[model samples]
Target chain A: MWRGFSMRVVSAFLIGLLFGLGLVVSQMINPAKVIGFLDIAGDWDPTLLVVMAAALATTFLGYRLVLKRGKPVLDASFRLPTNTVIDRPLLIGAGLFGVGWAMAGLCPGPAISAAAVGGPAPWIFVAAMACGMQGQRLIRP
Target chain B: MVEFTPLSGAVGGFVIGLAAVLFMAVNGRVAGISGILAGVLTPVRGDWAWRAAFMAGLFAAPLAFWLATSEKPQVVFDHPLWLVALGGVLVGFGARLGGGCTSGHGVCGMARLSRRSIAATATFMATAMISVFVLHHLAGF
Candidate 1:
């Protein structure tokens, strides 16, 4: 059991490392680049669009191939999202997230990755994000 | 003007997707950064090791690159500290309430052809674009 658990942990680490490297290589770590992509009325950068398309195509095919197996290598079953409700919270929350994203051009993934190499801004953003997350839990939980 | 980098974007995006596929195959979990970070914050017994390890890997990516190539990833923060903090808060609370962020909903969930994810992605994308337009064009930020 310990061996299996360790293997899962190692795999997760490597996967995260790869994802971070991808973010760096794709220049997603740059807030200006992300904002440039979002800026349709100005000097827009379509690089993010290409990145999204590539990621989507790969994931679309990759998930199908992976899920065809009976179960995961380290787990008994695939732990996928079960929720399908398109409700108010999802819409409102996502909209709020969008506003925040445009304001700073940093989402959760990039923010975390950027904190490693960026200045105090990323750290401050991360700390505030934690507070927000905890606040939500307190309010809802 | 923002530089176009379709080649690196596609390459990096494919790598990101590959990491996500590997993670799902072995760990049977979604590679959602916000959800993963939240789990680390309020860790439960027997479930925190992998999450911590994944985050450690993310942090290590920059260090590894710096050691190997002696090059740090570019990160720009044009917004003030207050806006950054506020954006972080909204993102954290919003992601939790909405149930997922870009990686979970935009990449993985959409790849699996989930309707809820699709709606959330569309909604966030639209709002983000609108917000950018308002901020950059209308408000002249």
Candidate 2:
């Protein structure tokens, strides 16, 4: 059990490392770049669209091929999202998230990754985000 | 377009896809940034360990990169402090209520052909574009 737990932790770290590196290499961590992608009426950047397409294409093939196997390599079963219905909360919540992302040009992943290399600004954003999350638990719970 | 890097974007995206695949294969987990961050904050038994490790690796990767290459991600904040904080709050709340964000719905979930993820991805992306339009084109914000 201990061995399995350690393996999971180590692999998780490596995977996270790879992800962060991808964000940096792709320059997704740059707010100017992301916002530029959003600035459609202005000088819009299509680079992000290509990045998303490349990721989607690769993962589309990857998931289909991998799921054909009996089960995931490490776990007993594949853990996948089962929710299918589009509801109000999903819509409203997504709208809010989109607006927020546009305002700051940092999603959760980029925020954390940015904080690793930055000053107090990212931390403040993260702290505010935490409070918002905690507020959700309180208000909705 | 202000600036573009097609090759690096595609290559980085490919790396991200591979990391997501490895994460799902070995850990049987979705590499959703919001979900993982929320999980760490909520802390259900036996679940927080991997989240913690993954987050640690997020920071560690940039640190390692800086050590090796003397470079880090470049981020700028043009918004007011209040707006930035509010943006963070909305992102946190919205991601929690919406169920996932770019990594989950946009990349991993859409790739899997999950209907709900497809819907969520569309909704969030649309809103993101709209928000950008309103902020930049309409209001010059």
Interface RMSD for candidate 2 relative to the native interface:
1.4
Give the TM-scores of the predictions, in the order they appear.
0.97, 0.95
Question: Which regions of candidate 2 deviate over 4 angstroms?
Answer: none
Best by the DockQ measure: 1
Task: Give the C-alpha lDDT of model 1.
Answer: 0.88
Per-prediction DockQ, in order?
A: 0.82, 0.73
Inter-residue clash pairs, candidate 1: none
Pairs clashing within candidate 2: none
Tens-place lDDT per residue, model 2, B1-141, is 248889988987887888888888888878898999998999999888989899887777667778888876677766667767888898899888888888998899899887868888888778878888887788777
* lDDT (Cα, tens digit) per residue for candidate 2, span A22-95: 87777776667788887787788887888888888988888877888777766777888888888888888888
User: Which one is best on TM-score?
Assistant: 1
**Number of the top-ranking candidate, with lDDT as the measure:** 1
CA lDDT of every candidate: 0.88, 0.82
